[model samples]
Target: MAFEQSLRRPVAATIRMIVPAGGAKPAPPVGPALGQYRLNLMTFCKDFNARTQHIKPETPMSVLLTAYKDNTFDFIVKSPSVTWYLKKAAGIQAGSGKPGHETVATLSVKHIYEIAKIKQTDPNCQTMPLESICKSIISTARTMGIKVLKELD
Candidate 1:
C-alpha cells in the first residue's frame, strides 16, 4: 500500500547513483581483477578478452531490455539501478560491461548468486555472508519503488 510505495522511492534514487547504465566504455575494465579478483587473476584475464573488445562502440548507454534478443525478465528496467541491484544481489561490486574484459554482461539473479557476499569472503573478513542479504536488498528495492522484475516464490 502506501507504506510500500514510500519505501521503494528512495531505493530507486540510490540505485540511479550507483551505476549510470550508459553505453560500454571504450576500455572498460575487464575480468574480476581489472582492479582486484578474489579468486583467480588468470581466469579473469581470459574471461576479459573473450567478453569485451567487440562492441560497435560509440553507442548511447542506457538500460534497454529491448536491445537484447534473449531478454526474458518479467519487468524490463533499463537503468543503472537495475545494474546496481544485480551486482548487489551477486555480493560484488560492478565490473565492466564486457564479460571477459570487466563484467560478464547482464544476467538474471537466479543465474548469479550461489551465496551471499559475506559467505564468499575470506574467513578473516570478519563477517559471514548471510543468506538473507539478497532478500534484504530485494525488500529494500521494493520499498524504493522499482519494479522487482522477478517472482519471489
Candidate 2:
C-alpha cells in the first residue's frame, strides 16, 4: 500500500483549453500549450480525438488537464459552453453587440430550464441547486441579448 501511494505524484499544473471535437492536432495551440510541460503532444492529440469522436466534428469542447510531477497527465472533457447552447436554442449566429440596448433573440423560460439541466450534469455544477443553475442560465441569456419569456406567445 505504501509503495502504491509513493508512486502517485502531486499535480504540478492545470491547463484549460477549448478544443474542437475530434480536431486535436500537434500544432499551434495544443503544441505550444503542452510543449512547455514536456508532455507527449501526439498522445494527447490521439486520445482527445478518440474520446471526442462521438460528438459532431468541429463542435467546441472544453477540456481541463492536470499534469503531474512525473510528466504523466489526466484530463476531463466538459460539455459546450452555455453561450454555445444559448445560440443554438435561439437560432442565432452571435450575440447582439449592444446587449442591453438591442435584443438578438428571444428564449422561453422553458429553454432556460432545459439549459440549466444540461449544465447541471457538469462536474463543477453537480453540487449546485437546480434553481440556482436556472438563474445563472437566465443571467447568461440576458447578457447575450436573449430575452427570456415565461412562455412563447
Candidate 3:
C-alpha cells in the first residue's frame, strides 16, 4: 500500500502562500512560484478564484499547496487570519502600537462568538472546541488593544 501510494503521487514541493480572495492571477508572486514547478498556473488560478468567490475580494487567504512530481498539484484554502477578522469587526485600520496602554477599539462578546464560529470552519480549528477558539480570539483581541465587552454599551 505504501509503495503504491508513493508511486502514485510523489510530492515534489510543498508551498505556502497568502493570496487575495478571488484575485488569483498569472502574475508575479503566483506565477513565478508555480511556474517554476511546471504546474498549470491558469488551472490553479481559475479553481482558486472560483472557490473564494463567496468571500470578500482582497481578503487574505492562506493556502497550502502540494506539487507532485507529475506537475499536478493540490491545495487547501484556510480561513483568513483572526487578526483580519478582528480588525474588520472593530472597524480599525491597524492594531494599537502600545497594545496594553493604548485602547484602539471595543468588541462585544457576540462579536467574539461570531468570529469564533467563522474560524471553526477552518480545517485546523474543526477539531477544537468552540470555547477554545473563542478564548484564543479574545487573547488576540487583547494583544491588539481591542477591549472585549459584555455588551455594546
Candidate 2 overall Cα lDDT vs. reference?
A: 0.92
**Each model's TM-score?**
0.22, 0.89, 0.93
Q: Which stretches of candidate 2 lie above 4 Å from their native place?
A: 1-8
lDDT of 2 by residue, 1-153 (tens): 999999878888999999999999988678888888889999999999999999999989999999887888999998899999999999999998998899999999999899889888889999999999999988898898999999998
Give the runs in model 1 whose Cα sits over 4 Å from its true position: 1-83, 87-126, 149-153
Return the candidate ranking by TM-score, descending.
3, 2, 1
Write the candidate numbers in order of decreasing lDDT: 3, 2, 1
**What's model 3's overall lDDT?**
0.96
Tens digits of per-residue lDDT for model 3 on 1-153?
988876778899999889999999999679988999999999999999999999999999999999998999999999999999999999999999999999999999999999999999999999999999999999999999999999998
